[model samples]
Target: MKNYLSSSQMTLRMFAADLLVLSSILSAAWCLSVLNVSVPKTLNSTSGSCLLIPCLFNISKEKQNILDSSPEVTWRRGSLWSLYDTDGFTIAHRQKEPVMEVVGDLRKKNCTSVMRNLTSLHSDRYYFRIQAENSGVTGTTAVHINVSESVAEPNVTVPVLREGEEVNLTCTVPAPCPSHPPNVTWAPALGGDVTQRTHLNADGTQSVSAILNFVPSVHHHELKVNCVSIHPLHREDRPLLSHKVVILNVEYPPKETWISLTGLVWLGDNVTLTCQSKANPPAVHRWFMKRAGVEEELSISHVLSFTAAHENTGEYICEAQNLCGAMNSTNLQITVLGISFTAFLSILAALSLIFALLAIAIVMIYRRYKEPIRSETNQDQNIYANMSASAVKSEQLQSKPCEDKNTCTINPVYAFKHDLPDENIYANC
Candidate 1:
């Protein structure tokens, strides 16, 4: 019995501990649910621009026991406390009664409201109050409204256009305007009014446009257009954003011209030439060959099939013209190979004839000098013959010196001729 009681006591103690943990968890969950039932705390806006302030709250339970239509939603700005009112603070569907003239929608069960057409004076802390039977359970949300004085500016875009093409001008504002709609005006670049259109947003903001529909002219290209946005609250003619310019560029004519080599052809053969021009309406190309004393216009293909000669070796002009302007090409040279070859042969023949004459002149001069050389050779032979005879006579006289002893003496007349005693030759004679 004692062991049984001890076991029972231990079981009871464990049950009590588990119950305590469950109670703590339930308390924490309840605190979290209460904390999650509050509204968002801040809101912001720009000056001179329209804004929407949202008032919303969160509820913890899904029970439908709470009436969806009885919660009251109220909004206050600065020291003023009565701007917006609704039936239910946590209900999703409730009718709204707004004290301000601004247009907005209110949701009751969700406990949220949107205020539009905000101005700079609306910059303040806004408080929301809800009336319910469970007064302490009702939630309040505080919002800080930030309003600036900078107004919305319009955007403009320009595109490259062509003649007779329709041009569109669009102007877009950055944000919606709650207080007043902006007026857009269009004036021609030169100074004239065109058709205009306007579009409105549900928030009371507006966008306007102007269009000029006419065949684009050079005059229009040089002119400018204006996009003006006038604030309704401001003075008439005084646009908050004014005088945006739009310039139009139109494509009309091709601005380039060119020509290319067709191919090579033999002498007396036919060849083709081509001329090209770039223009909007396409250009007309004319080919002219400056032959001897004539400038004949060739056909569109400009294929001159005549036998090419030296006379045809002049400038061939390709003229391209369009409605806008005309351009001419440099003269192309056409050469005839037959004429070139003939001229080369003539030069070689003249050189051969000159060389033959030079050879004949050299042969005649050699023949004319040959006879005088032969005569000089004969004279030299005679002088050698006389010297030999004198030498023979002197030898004979020297041998016979015994017969004529006195003759052996040297002779003064011939002493210079031989290195011998002068008495010998003289005595022999």
Candidate 2:
């Protein structure tokens, strides 16, 4: 009978112990439910970097008055099941030394926390806990953290572009997170020509892509095409995270060609003329000269260098061409400071030839006229001498009027006059 009585008393004491423990648990639950914490369920960040978590706490206004003017906030890295888990370390605390470092103000009811030096191994949930001093109230919230490796530059695929042909530049990058992906933007943005899309990856990630489409021209040659990613967890200076840039390999002919020559060139001076143009397939150049409205091809190269002289002076032109067509530069008039010695000698030789021809013509005419004038004067003098002799003979014949008729010849003057057939000559005799 005494053993039965002792067992009954022990049973009662055990029941009371159970009741007291249940009462204490219920009171704690009630207090915790009143102090509520709100925060996002999931957040993403990059590995080897920092993460900022937004948090807020709410409690009855009555409790606010009762609590200490200065409340305390703490952050620890653990799951909800490990509320009192001492294995978890405190990363941040209000008015106390932080685990690493925090960069926000909590006095103004900002419960935001910053996690630093995070890695893929840090892929765990964190909890925020707040203490209202003397009010015997506290709130807690959970934050699921996803830390991924830093982004890599996008893969680029671009084909060589032919003139007037359409082409595309494609770039792809692995998404930073499955829930939160980075945005893609093209460098030197092409309006209405950019295309973007995304694909789901097997490892709970996404692959984002962008493409630029256009018809290539010579103007597009050597231009850089870039695909840039803007990351959510990037720093201020490094807002853009990953990128890929490639030079456009477009092919076309020469354009806007031109030649350049020194102004006011002088004779015997070293001269250089350059042929310049914009082209994709690199234009082959040649130099030319235009004189007397005629073209003279000079060189088949980009530059023309020579010593200046009168012969070299003219309208100089540079012709640049590729597979497409020919392009000519504006004419540049090259003038010399003075005439060269060779030019002076050439002029003197021409003048000497003309003078020699004129002198030969004058000598030929003088020789032809000198003989005729001299012959005519000799004939006139002989005629005058003959006439004088004839007159003297006629006087003698008249004085010897003849008796010897048989042997007499007619007066020679009379006989000559009979044959003369001129009345005036007969009277003179």
lDDT per residue as tens, model 1, 1-429? 999999999999999988877775565445334422233454444443444443345554542333354544555444322212333532321222223321233333444444554456666666554444553123334566566555444567656555556665565543234345556656543333356566654433345565544556445654666666665432223435545666555545444455566555445555556676555456677888787757887755423345566566766887776665667777777765654445667888999999999999999999899989999999999999999998888777655544444333353244233346889989999
Pairs with backbone N, CA or C atoms under 3 Å apart (clashes), candidate 2: none
Over 1-429, each residue of candidate 2 has an lDDT whose tens digit, in order, gives: 999999999999999998987887676666667667666787666774565565666666666553356555556555343334343244332223223333345444456566665667777766665555554554556778787676667788888787787887788776544334568768875433888889764433356788888787766778887889766643334543888888878877777888776566766778888889987678899888999899999889988999987888789888888876678888888877695546667889999999999999999999999998999989998998899899888777777765654344466634432344478767998
Candidate 2 least-lDDT 10 residues = 93-102
RMSD of each: 17.8, 22.3
Q: What is the lDDT of residue 415 in candidate 1?
A: 27
lDDT of each: 0.54, 0.69
Off by over 4 Å in 1: 1-147, 189-206, 211-214, 234-239, 255-429
| lDDT of candidate 2 at residue 263, scale 0 to 100 | 64
